[model samples]
Target: MKKLLFTSLLLVSSTEAFAKDITVTLEVPSMDCATCPITVEKALERVKGVKEVDVTFENKLAVVIFDDEVTSPDALTKATENAGFPSRIKS
Candidate 1:
């Protein structure tokens, strides 16, 4: 019984190893001020599985790295939008 429990725990933890980390660049065209990047970055950081976020007001871009199994690009965009800065995936 102990061995079976240990195997189950290992299997559950190993699922995360199969999750891919994806990096996405989003264009936040409405960020017209320096503080805009701060807000955008904060919003992204609040998202689950978000590993990193880099927002630049000068380029109006947000680079995000997150676990694909926990979140998605669409969810990232929605986060910025909810913060009042709408964004889209860069082409």
Candidate 2:
């Protein structure tokens, strides 16, 4: 009975879907004034599977959460750069 229960639990747990750890925090060198967040948010929003985006003008940082299955951190960075702002991954 224990073996059966364990097997069932394993299968159920394995079948459940979970969010991936695909968060990226980066600094935008070109972000100087107020409109920076708007630009960053709009650029990131166009990407598929991007669930959240937070941009800090004061700190010049952008943190994004995206689905790995749909997009990648590299792609996210590229998108930000293309939006007329240069960015680097925060260490």
lDDT (C-alpha, whole model) for all candidates: 0.96, 0.86
Candidate 2 — worst ten consecutive residues by lDDT sum? 12-21
Give, for candidate 1, the lowest lDDT window spanning 10 residues: 12-21
lDDT by residue for model 2 (7-90), tens: 999887875555464888988889878988799889988989899999989988899988887888788888888998878888
- The per-candidate count of clashes, in order, stands at 0, 0
Q: What lDDT score is found at residue 88 in candidate 2?
A: 81
TM-score of each candidate structure, all chains considered together: 0.86, 0.76
lDDT of 1 by residue, 35-82 (tens): 989999999999999999999988999999999999999999999999
Candidate 2 residue pairs in clash (backbone atoms < 3 Å) = none
User: After superposition, which runs of candidate 2 have C-alpha atoms over 4 Å from their true positions?
Assistant: 1-21
- Candidate whose TM-score is highest: 1
Q: Stretches of candidate 1 above 4 Å error?
A: 1-13
- Go through the candidates in order and give the C-alpha RMSD of each one to the true structure: 1.9, 4.3
Error of 1 at 71 (Å): 0.5
Candidate topping lDDT: 1
